[model samples]
Target: MARSTTDSSSSGSSSSSSSSSSSSSSSSSGSSSSSGCHFHYVIGDKIDKYVITKYLCSGTFGMVLEVIDEQGIPYAVKVIRLIFRS
Candidate 1:
């Protein structure tokens, strides 16, 4: 079995996500390819009362997506990677 982990810390009003992965295959490329794919949200998916609209962008930390509320007002929602740290 393989697993991945993440750690997050808050500095004042800012936060960060660190990704760690291990797999059956020893290939580093295999681990890198799976990073940031933890999120299950997609277009038309509803979460936190917001409906996912589009995938804006992504970084090593997380991804940002466009979402809309019931009122149709759009907003930028940041969905970070899963954090496994205690």
Candidate 2:
């Protein structure tokens, strides 16, 4: 897969530099764990080659995010949280 670098500053937030890979893998800007697992992804977060643009919505199971590819093509991705029993 191809990799690309993006300017996080475009999202209007100041953060450390990060790179993105061209793959279908899932990622997040950050995450937090409480009763279950919650993933927090912000705008400009590069997951694969797509940059998160807007947060569509979230449910008890997961969330839908609006992202755009390097070519400016928009797409929606669903992030699901898995619960593990020990």
Q: Per-residue lDDT of 1-86 in model 2, one digit per residue for the tens?
A: 12322222132212211222232334444355531336666568777778887655456876555667788755555566766779
Clashing pairs in 1: none
The superposed Cα distance between candidate 2 and the true structure at residue 17, in angstroms, equals 28
TM-score for each predicted model, relative to the true structure: 0.53, 0.54
lDDT of 1 by residue, 1-86 (tens): 01111222121121211111121112212122454646664468776556656555557777655556577655555557765797
Q: How many clashing pairs per prediction, in order? A: 0, 0
CA lDDT of each candidate?
0.46, 0.52
